[model samples]
Target: MYNLKNKTMKNFMTIALLLVMVNTYAQQVDSIKTTKVETVTDTVNGEITSKKIKTITLKEQAVKTDPADKGKLNADRIFPPTKVKKTVMVDYDADPFYDEKTTLKYFELNNDNYVFRKSNDGFIMNVLNKDEEVLKANARQTKSGPYYVVNSNEFDGIGFFNKEKKFVLEFYNQKTDKLETIEFAEK
Candidate 1:
């Protein structure tokens, strides 16, 4: 009878230990699941969301123009080239690759406006614009004869002009503190 009791006690102890281990493992699994859920909730709260906006005020609308049409200067037809004052900067030479795309024809025309001849459905530019700023316009030979620039001096150009084909410019002699408008367009 003593032997039977000892055997029963051993079996009970083994079963008890296994039960404790199983409970501990289940508790670990629950803790891990809780941590994962909390992490997912935090991420959702931190994420930013954007919505589509569809509203415009009447004043913000733009005027519509014909799609298949070209605009021409109303000079002579309506507004005879209104004399306007503007600062013109002259650039002798600039990078053709980059300057050709960003400069405007009005600012780049040389003294002798470019002479254009029609060819291959486009005009050829025999000369180039002097104003580096104008030539930089991303303009190429359009239907209009090769772009030509008029002498700005004739348009009340900041009080400097070589009416007699004289090249005029101001030279600042820093040493003499003298700012002089040198007019020597005609030798």
Candidate 2:
């Protein structure tokens, strides 16, 4: 009788431990179902300024198990749908006179207005009159894209096309000792 009682108690203890383990595992799965992730990006002047990722756990839901339908899992019924919000920011400032198609490297700037063209020989500075005629003073590429710099007694800047095909220009400001950027986007 003593041996039989000991065996019964051992069985009860083993069953209790297994029940605790199963409950713990169920809680872990429930936690995973309620987890949410969010992503955010900020862009300035066609460049990524910052990115952020965050994860959060939502309220727990009551899950039901059917002994008759064992091993058949319905994911939609087990976990409800969650909505995530994403945010992005873009900033652009473009120069009005730069043209990407012309084969010359020189650009004309007159009273805050200018025209840019590519040339094979050297730098070309032209002053445009009221009739839109070119008055050549100093300078003058291929149809293919190449990085180019425009520097003259009055204007100093660099122009290039980015991978996204956006025309970007950086102008040096001698008075403030800073570089001002201008970008032209196709879209």
Candidate 3:
């Protein structure tokens, strides 16, 4: 009877230890969830805008014991490989010329005082509402042909003549600080 009592106590102690280990493992796995939040804001023309983004990640906490390593946890098997992704966003006010999806050939300059004309001699600055011509500069000649360079002065850019003898003008926009290309086909 004494031997039987000792065996039963030993078995009870073993079951209790197994239960404790299982509970500890379950707790570790449950703690692997994480949450992250991000916010972005921008101010344009006296108006403020903001955006919030959230991310949730879960990692596996289970480790496999390697038989070859004397029952030690395998470092490579503990964590799974994850892939990273990247995103890009673009935001800007709508531009009329860009929204049209057509290449510009003409632009009114200085409150309609001058109309830019594209010609073989680069862009011609002409008086608006008049047939008078103001200034004409020939595009710089290259081995392939005349390739105009866009500059700040607007008139200091290149012009190309199509078969119809109309001008295509490329110049710099001072306000937007961008290069603009337009074609003026009207004779």
Model 1 TM-score relative to the real fold: 0.17
Best by TM-score: 2
In model 3, which runs have C-alpha deviations exceeding 4 angstroms? 1-125, 128-132, 136-140, 148-152, 163-165
Alpha carbon lDDT at 159, candidate 3: 64
How do the residues 17-52 of candidate 2 rate in per-residue lDDT, one tens digit apiece? 999999877764333323233334677799875333
* Model 2 misplaced regions, further than 4 Å: 1-113, 121-127, 132-145, 162-167, 183-187
Give lDDT tens digits, candidate 3, residues 126-187: 55466555553344444467555534334556666678545566776778888886665432
Ranking by TM-score: 2, 3, 1
For all candidates, the clash counts are 14, 11, 8
**Off by more than 4 A, model 1:** 31-187
Lowest summed lDDT across 10 adjacent residues in model 3 is found at 96-105
TM-score of each: 0.17, 0.28, 0.27
Ranking by lDDT: 3, 2, 1
